[model samples]
Target: MYKLLVIEDDVMMSDMLSMYMSGEGYEIKQAENGEQGLKLLEQFVPDVVLLDLMLPDWDGTELCIRMRQHSTVPIMIVSMKSEVSERVQALRAGADDYLCKPFSMHELSARVEALIRRARLMQPNAAGGQQEEAGQASEKEIKLDSERRLLLVRGTFVETTFSEFEIMKLFLTHPGKVFSREDLINAIRGFDSFVTDRAIDVHIVNLRRKVEKNPKEPHYIRTVWGVGYKYVTEVEATR
Candidate 1:
């Protein structure tokens, strides 16, 4: 069975989400604040994380940044703040998917199921026996080809670590698609790889510093106010 972590401050909200997800046959863990959520991540390697943007100790976006520094667990934002800016910011912080509050149970279940399904599909090749062909390709030096690889400022022969390359590949492949820390974790980590979610954010920061012209106000990797990061492309490519 897949295990899930839910980070929410509201006792009732967290309980309801936990119970419903539990009924779905998933092992559910709950945290009242970002601090506790980080601790849970260290102790329990959940398959997916249901993250809330608003937390007592830390904002959800900040938590996402911290978590991305360590892990790639898929994160789905379950929050009440529906502002476009908020959603864009969450995505920029590393959220995989955004879901507004006052949502339906069925919708929640579907979202969780989708996250699990995607996570399974993203497993490392050869049943986790080896790093797999994709990893090897990412590790091996290859020539820079913007059109072929969907790469932007970073070149194919990027002088960076494998973790940074993995994050870049995701953006290149799906330009303009927002990815939170949780999404980054789920998409990159191997099926059996043990890493914290915050670790993912560290990689993102490093990656930006390496590739972006200005990491602070980046042009290639622009943060969505209420969502996550999106790799903006040139107009010629849009056609």
Candidate 2:
């Protein structure tokens, strides 16, 4: 059974989520504040976390940042704040998805299901097999270890978020293919996620910072003027 950790201060809201998500067959754990939530996060190790932005003990974004330092579990921000800036902040803080309050239980369930599905897909190879490596082997060695969900640049592991990893995986698999912002958003978050096009730009920028020696003049992920971005193929990287 997939486990879910819900960190919500609202008593009624927490109860509602527990009841509804339980009915959906997810093993549920609740935390009324940030500190308690962090404790439960380590002990329970849930597959997905449903977090609220307004916590009496801690700011949701800060908590999200802290969580990212220790775990890669998918986080979905369920908050009353509907502003684009607020959503972007949470995403930049390491949230994988965002859902506004007053949401339907059905939609919440669907998003949770999607999160679990993606998590499973990204797990290390089940048979203890060799880690798959894909990338150019020229002066700059870029390697993708799917089993570890890690991106290695010049033999160094570059930390990446779930979305960042997915984007890189896609780029490495199909180098030289131009993917629009919408395409990337859909590919990583799926059509159900509440994400804006600008969010993709933020992800790309963050990714470049980690993968490129100098983000200003990116060599691997090139921006296609007027369209979107693409991973430079071996031949393209040479020029």
Candidate 3:
């Protein structure tokens, strides 16, 4: 079962979110204050966090920054404050997605599900038999920095666009996880709605143009015949 932690100071809203999310079949956990929230997080490593900005004890922005110090757990902010400055501040602090207050429970569910799915793509870049656990995805992200478009491909520093980096990171984090065009597009969409499956193919083409030793006859970014693409980690050794 997927786990979600809701950190909201408003008792009614917190209960409502918990009830609705629970109805959606998630294992819901709640905290009334940032302190309690952090305490709960120590014991419960959730797949996603639904955070409210205002709190009686500590601000959510500070908590977001603090969380980034130790975790790459996908955090989606649900807040009453709708100002652009506040939204930007939270995102800069490392919160992945921000949704304004009075959002539909269905929308909340959608965002939560999306974050978890995207986070899962960070495993399997191993080309052959061995594979890492889900938790290792976050550990690799700290060095990969997909948001900043930095990739550590076999210890080589490769720079690309944020979208390209996310694509590469997903492929590298999980070496052999086969993703279709739709799957990859959805994984990278996040708050941006301008992407299309054609766009994903275009990205693959561009990325192949950059990192492949022979972009014309690529080695690392291998097409899965009928499916999509995966980073071939063993390509370096095989070559």
Number of the top-ranking candidate, with lDDT as the measure: 2
Per-residue lDDT, model 2, residue 215, is 95
Q: Model 2: how far is 84 from its true place, Å?
A: 1.1
lDDT of 3 by residue, 113-210 (tens): 87887677443333222334243442232236534436654457677664676677677666656888877876667644578878998999998876
lDDT for every model? 0.70, 0.83, 0.75
Ten-residue segment with the worst summed lDDT in candidate 2? 125-134
Model 1 lDDT tens row, 123-212: 542233233324544322222232222233434344544346556766655556788767777665532144455687677778778666
Error (Å) of candidate 2 at residue 11 is 0.6
- Span of 10 residues, lowest total lDDT, candidate 1: 140-149
Q: Rank order by TM-score, top first? A: 2, 3, 1
User: Which candidate should be chosen as best, given TM-score against the real structure?
Assistant: 2
**Could you tell me every candidate's TM-score relative to the true structure?**
0.59, 0.69, 0.67
In TM-score terms, candidate 1 sits at 0.59
Q: Across residues 65-122, which tens digit of lDDT does each residue of candidate 2 receive?
A: 9998888898999999988789878876778888998999999999888888766754
Q: What is the lDDT of candidate 3?
A: 0.75
In model 3, which residue pairs have backbone atoms overlapping below 3 Å? 122-173, 123-173, 123-174, 124-173, 124-174, 124-175, 125-174, 125-175, 126-175
1 versus 3: better TM-score goes to: 3
